[model samples]
Target: MHDEGEPGDPDNKSVNSDPEVQQTLEVVFEEGDIRRRKSSLVPSTAPRPDHRRRKTQCFVHTLLEKHDGVASEDLNASYEGLAQERRVDKDPHSHAEQSQHSRLLTKKQISDMAFGIRELSKKLAQIKIMLHVRNIFILAKAHDETLIKHTRETTDWLLTKDESYRVYVEQTLEKNRLFDADGLLEKNPNYRGRLRFWTNELAAEKPQNFDIVLALGGDGTVLYASWLFQRIVPPVLAFSLGSLGFLTKFDYEQYPQTLSRAFTEGITVSLRLRFEATIMRSQDRENASRDLVEELIGEESEDHHTHRPDGTHNILNEVVVDRGPNPTMSSIELFGDDEHFTTVQADGVCISTPTGSTAYNLAAGGSLCHPDNPVILVTAICAHTLSFRPIILPDTIVLRAGVPYDARTSSWASFDGRERVELNPGDYVTISASRFPFPSVLPLDRKSKDWIDSISRTLHWNGRERQKSFKEWGS
Candidate 1:
């Protein structure tokens, strides 16, 4: 008759009420069963404190066992090795890290590390710069004993100074007594192996074989160097050793220093424009019909088919179309950008680049254009008409000069004062800015300053007596 909550009744008493009874129940239930029963009374999502405590104890026990016999020093070394391996995997090229511990590096050690990094950076820079110049082609004035002697001296100095550099001379020089085996050997015993001979054919075949062209003569020598390289021209360092040394600005005396700077520090270059002159024959017109069709259909015309020249020439100075050996004035029709521009009924016409404006263009009443100006100068060679004047056209224009099919006489064409070709009736010449420009190395001065000095010293431009000062005039 006792209630379930009553402590007096033995059968109705709680399991935890009597000590003997509880002990008997504990023995019967087991610890795991008691825990499960208690856990079932609470929410399943609640954290189990005993489980967390057991995990922590297991982790500590494993950690103690792992490091039970390891020394403190060995533990530090293990950590450092792991860090080093990570660094090596990150950047194989990088140097090892110097500071591993928390202690600050001494000032002297830090300075030494900085100096070592700077030295490494300098070595990398030098390695990058070393690949610039290895082969030098020397083009000196022909039939000049003084220049030849100077060339010998230069070759000797170059050979003695740098054993790595290879010198290339004109093949003709090999036959010359000046560059004979005895002469070369007298200068440098190893010249036979280091010095090489190159012909015009070889130069034409492999223009890129020469890294730099050293021209020792007047401006004409520089032009000859330009002529040798029809496609890509290397940097040309011209020494002033001839008459009218306009293009030859570098002093032969200072060549040692100049060349040294060019090799190491590098020299500034003035990329002068060149003209690709192609002579299109009248008979080729029929062959170009297919190219014309291709052009109409928005396809590029083949260069060899459309504007094939009898002999194409790359001119750095000018191209002249004139009455060669003909008494009558030549009749020439000019076209620009495929549009008819004018007809020249003069002795001849001169087409020159800005670099050549100082040459024939100046003599034909054309303006003195700066070499850097991107313009083509057209000047009449003794024009019959007084009103006809020189004209400057953009470099983008493609100039074509042709003899009319009904013309009286054939016209003559000369490229850079050479390679004279006859343009019969209906024949024409196409002139366009060449993709390959003439790279002329500047002297110690900048492009503008060098040009000014050349005109002042060489051409004696504006050399007339300076205007008297106002005070002098008054006196």
Candidate 2:
């Protein structure tokens, strides 16, 4: 029998020459096959240590040294191929010798090796992700000089803090000279290539490309950021600089601390709900062969076919369908999950998300729901019937509202109070919960508490004068 210090043994001086190879072998032996098998193998039943196991490990190190530039995946594939070849080339006549050779690595050893390879692959992947520079997109209120100054300060701070971060602003801001790029570059020449402009067209195409979104101004600015990213919205950090600070909970004065925390230790996010609104138009009414019910039920024909508009909108607040410049009340047929539920004869109807419950829905006397709740609020505007009241529905349901063919006047629909479209007699609008929710970063001291604070501070909820004491009244 060869001694431990022999030329072919794994403990030989020549085998431990290269530090990298030695380190790799140590890791594999400690956590992979060798350590496991040593503890499992019994003295009387187990095969004794032999030259073949040492030779196999030496071959693995040789393979690693020879293919030093190869990828980890390819190296793993090579090892698997070698193991397969060993199984196929066994001698059938010498059963005892074949058994001993194969017993070097049991099924557990192979599984452990694969598991180690996967863990190494995961670490490599994480390192690769960390190498890329983070991209931040800024969305602020338009035409505000004070906010513009604050934005420039924030931009300068970011550039000075991290050379790897790339900052992008709206094209309109650059074109209007609100964000003077030339002046910025003159002051900080190193930030020349790092500062960039993002147009609406580019933003719509690659909404998910940004790592984070920073909103300066009030809730309007935050909503505008939500509108810019129709799908796959990045995490948004909004600073309170507007008239309303509901969505913009963080103070602009504490930007340095807030932003530093966001950069170093990530911020907690509240995934706010949004609505997807689609407009479905019916074919020409004059040439239609089908009745109003048939056309509304989706009976397709050359003249009565229903076609959806080119694009759908992702609304953060609410979608309102109301009488547009008409003196008479509008008649609307509402359907819930494709079933006709009720007819709403009112000035209009509003469908909003839980995040928008405090907006138009609250103004129309709808229930105030928590933003985290998975619900949608449907509120009627000045209904003709006295019994009509606001109702809340699950977010999973799809709601459709259309003007009847015999209605006196056409109705108008607006998404988040914008993109107003006239709904013809047969046209309908569908509203549903979007798969992509807006991820807003909360303040360091806030989570659900921020919402409650906003309601009390902004709206003065439950505010009333206390009754005078009996002694004071008598005096």
Candidate 3:
């Protein structure tokens, strides 16, 4: 017989002839047949016998084998049960290659999503910066050739240096289409994309919405810009281009550097006080005449010169009530908060704010008060009475000035050296602090100088021979 053993050998022949060898062969053959039948009953995707054997040996199979006194039959039964349970607990088709591939794909997807989020964040940040810059309004002095030239040069410099600025000029000057004509912002080929023009009428029609008002002229130009915006005046950056640049001290040469600092580091601003003056006619003229009636009663007044003064005029400087074409001195009565203050017999009477104390008030022998002082000044212009002197009063009190129904002649009231109105007999003007104020921009170094430098440089405050040096006095 062809026994399943080493071929053509005496030992193999002997073993094949033995009964034990034949019995063992029959058992092995039967076990193999049973395994084949079980495998065929399972799905094609099921765990193979070799795989099941490896899994079973991993845990319980090896653990149980390590113990002594455990029967082979018990080990076999435990191996079969644990292997079947393990197969049912997991996916049959699951493999190390498929799991590794899935992990790699998940990682790549997460990386791409993170990259997209970072790019979106950068775009939003860029958009925010674009919306932060403010618009600029430019006001230049008119008629002066030197001032006009400097203003145009400054505008050109600003356009070249900062592309972000949205610049605007007055429409009246711009209408001429000539940069020199009233110093208007015209259709100059030199203008950049952001330049534009506005009209006072347009500004009045719709309140202008500008962040800063840049005045390229003298102190008067800055004051003019303040009057333009009756409701709200933007912070002013005034440059010195005219005589007596007391308020306008910034030099045009240092504008580029200084303006850059203002934009980047912010600027210092001083709040200046503004006052309102309203003129009115007395209700009972001839009957209410109490003092100085003889001169007014006999004079024949021209009908053309008489007009009712109703509206209030805002004054940054002083309001002057003077003898208008009258050969006689003005007899003006002053009242504080409706109380009898005094009577000023002078060429005129001037009511001024602390800011104006440096102007006409100074010329009239009034005290030079600091701009920060919250006070009003009353100075008489060439007073006829020796006792009449300039007086400083608290800004809290309302001031009233009038020609007593008995005044000798009429007086003229002018505000900021402009807008003259005739005051007839029994006429009174009421003056009070205004709610709106002017915010004037100051140099970054204003805190250290305290306006002393401006006074020294512009007005030459203490300019005089050094009191004839003591040593040279006798020589």
Candidate 4:
């Protein structure tokens, strides 16, 4: 036995040789797997400080309307110029007032700003990746074929150079599976092989199996992607690749490296609150049982009944009851959980969540909200009443809004731009918050703060230019 034990291979690198200290290293670079195909990026606008600017100007205008454009413009320009000088000027003590102004940011505000800045940087990285994802998703349908062609060329280059991508696919889909797992892919390379995350295959396929979805698009893509996953939602990593991205956070260059760390070091996951919606119609009393069942459960189909049911829905944006193409107003009733708060005779009405504040809500003159808040914004599109104004509601109340059909008026109701219903006079529609919140992954650790900060930088919210350009110095 002693003779048979020829010396154990001392040169072996296997973990079994030395259990106390194990080492891991890559053998083959499997980064070549992601094949190249064109993808599409949904259109997105960058965050703007228009709202903040408008508000500030409104404040300025309210206080000094006579000065109008000139005063506000010159004052803002002066602030920007001074702020820039403070930043680049070598001597910190050169301007005592400037130093004091910098100090006025306060410890808490500074801490908050720092946190926001860091988060925004990370988000910018994610946005780049998200844009790539969008290019992959939307390349097929882009209006500009040249842009599509350009993406295809770029993707091919990245596929060859992006080693981390190959690692992602390889590590995610392990080869040499000795054991069997049910309902999993049969080690197929098509699913596991070189998947170029673009075209129809990516648009339809990876969604089923990807570990984390990195949105390389913008806010529109994020919204679209989140809406697709009705159940069993996965985490998303987004990088903005567009000119301006509210949802896209990561930078494009960070892809190869950041994704490397994400795989080797995992990524931070966030839970975004999503709201589900139910649609009900007026004049359908007989199907009330089914309709009511769906109402409580947020089901999709219309509940058919003998009586005309009202049109209402638990919507992500808002339940819109409007008079389409007509110069007439829509007499709509707004019902709270306990009782009807009031009625508004207007062109249309919008009910939205805090998450949707940046969306259609903002367009209708509603306030932007921090993503975490649970509040509803009720705005009148064009109200006939002089006193008609937008109202804020507690998120808890289920808001019922619809034109009274039996009132002998023609009105329409829409949910998230789809599923339209017409309310006959005297009939009514109902709306409320669905039980489910759209759960989206922010990708970065500081998604909310970063989102807010992006609003500042991209929109220049309350903006005094952080710095002065060389051209400005000549001015």
Candidate 5:
């Protein structure tokens, strides 16, 4: 006969069955209440304290201690131990330990826990951090449809700050369909309402009121938005929705969950190296007359040069001076941190951050940089001379390029890909690390190398032949 006895039966065979089990399962019936009894699982020699039952949803664990009716001395001892004996070890992730209980755990265990808790944590953290970085903002470019598409896919209350986006969303909802590059998604109840799109400029509007910002687009979107912020940039998450993803490591598919944690939950933060460039105009005595002269030659240099005259601000990418669509030779002047390391030239010049090195710098033949290092990559766009090779420099040095009257539009300056003031005859462009940098957000699983790996996968940058046996691959 299988008797489903209540927890404590007057005559139970399982409780006092084994001699060892009987010793461990001591039952102290409440003096006044027989139905309610404290589990006496602790041995007299054991140091186990009484633990009160909490919300069962917190854990499926069975606490091994006295249930209910805690002893004053045991409670005091447990609290004292928690306060005195617990201390975090000094390490990279010590910040993670500050608000958590100190326990002797392995690296693998900590990583597993972080991975499990990450999704919800970001949502919880975002609200507090956004307030802390109130002046921070999010920017989107017109071209970054993918990032814009996904930003609305997985977030809540994102519309609270972006009203323009909300209007667009309502319009889209009224239309009840989508017009993607691939064609429209079918109209149906499932597709009736979907993701909303927003740009990064929303952050720049009231720059002093927000604490965090995001540039939802490809490298170009991020680059342009970053410029608008100038030196007052907030931490940015480069949400990439493009095929050629070098700067943005985040995936659009997981944006909702990820964005919530990052903006609301407070899971992770990252800092990205940025390069700043200054576009200097010609200081020739006949500058105005030259402008008139060039006008007579049917060459208008209004967009190429600024009216303010102090030179453009610092750039985050290389300071380039090269033939724009016109195949011509350019003599670009170079400078070093000190004069001894100076005097180098080629077709043009590129000064990039460890981050930008992977962009135009890579295309123009420069070294890839580790994001953490504060170094610049200066490479020639295309050199006619054998003496020119890309050089790495401390961000301290200021590099310059001047176009002679004969050179014409054979020289230009670009920052991150946001076309800065182009160089023309009599125009000298100066390049240096900007005082400002782009603060980025990194998921726990990502790093600079991860970016390179992601680019490789998305663009098929470098597809290698299968080194492993074919039996392990296609099958």
Candidate 6:
């Protein structure tokens, strides 16, 4: 038997030679894995004090003093429970370990993710390829109550028409929505907000986004819509509610098919030319005083005022420089491309685009030119010389008409039969082909054949008693 004080004894207490303490110290120092694990489910406690008591003497003693009833055996049981839970969490077959493995994606998962991305790209390409039809802005004559009523009737009829028409209108309403021109929304409550109203109140608003413009009045209404969109005027489907629907040839009764076809199959769009004219004072090299010019351009030119933001004016038909309140004929000097062309001593001058050939130009004895003709028609309104007739010039050139400073009186210039300005002595008006052109939708059934039909139907062109045949004349 070994003595109790033996130097190499296996049961020495003072020398601290216990195998459990030695094994624990070896695990702590050699493994170097003394980290605290956190868990919400388990109650936390201070670390074990067997090996750490010397290093953390103050902390262990303080805990022992505070919890006087806690025994060493109870603390050992808690530490063992925590260690078992941690070991299970790190086990390869445990639920927590399996969940960690699941987060790491495999090759098959990466391939499936790539395939999903490609399918999404293909679907987006198909969506981009589909044809898109948007909103239709409708314009009706404001002052005419009867015409406004008729327009509302047409809209209501469109909803209750054949299933095709109803579906088209509903889809259009859904995709892009419908809008009424300015004040028409107030008069008709049915359209309230479903069909929005746009006016000058929305300062910067324009009709660029609208796909098409539908006019429910006469040819004048169609012209008004053209003026509304000063830039690129969209295709217009004009319905004739006037005495003679010459320009507005589409019958309101047969609008279901025509409107649908315009929305789907599309129609032949007639590009009608327009002209922009600017009026400048003659004597003043710069510009005349606004008050002086406004006084000279009195209330007589009130009809010419438009809500256009820019001071410059655009005209679809013609500009007439006539002798206004002046007894004498207007002495006008015309220039082509800045070169003096001719001096016309006439009642007035009618500068018209081919689209306006049948307007004031026709009534003034000017030849009717096709709308497709790219020419400017200048006709004299009762000229002094019989030889000075109407002439057609290429649209590529700019024409400037001036009232001579030595003229008998000042002349008045009107645009599209409206917005008139007084041309004082030396005052001149410049005319050129506008960058924007009107896109007019032609009739599907008759197409552009309505031009000659309008001339014969409206003007009764060349209507006369049939000439006697040669056989009847006894030749």
Best of the candidates, lDDT:
2
Model 3 worst lDDT window (10 residues): 23-32
Clashing pairs in 3: 171-198, 292-406
lDDT of 6 by residue, 38-113 (tens): 6544555755557543334585565565435766444444643343332110111234333322112222332233
Worst 10 residues of 5 by lDDT: 1-10
Instruction: Give the Cα lDDT of each candidate.
Output: 0.67, 0.68, 0.61, 0.46, 0.47, 0.58
Per residue, candidate 3 scores C-alpha lDDT tens digits across 296-408 of 22232212122233656667888999998999999897776425687788899999988888889999999888777777899999999888878998765567677876678
Candidate 3 Cα errors over 4 Å, as ranges: 1-133, 175-193, 204-208, 283-309, 465-475
In model 1, the number of clashes is 0
Q: List the residue pairs that clash in candidate 6.
A: 282-426, 304-418, 304-419
Model 2 stretches with alpha carbons more than 4 Å out:
1-133, 175-178, 285-304, 466-475
TM-score of each: 0.67, 0.68, 0.63, 0.52, 0.53, 0.59
How do these models rank on lDDT, best leading?
Answer: 2, 1, 3, 6, 5, 4
The alpha-carbon deviation from the true structure for residue 98 of candidate 3, after best TM-score superposition, in angstroms, is 82
Runs of candidate 6 with Cα error greater than 4 angstroms are 1-132, 157-193, 200-204, 283-310, 472-475
**What is the TM-score (0 to 1) of candidate 5?**
0.53
Candidate 6 least-lDDT 10 residues: 21-30
The TM-score ranking, best first, is 2, 1, 3, 6, 5, 4
Superior candidate under lDDT, 2 versus 4 = 2
Better of 1 and 2 by lDDT: 2
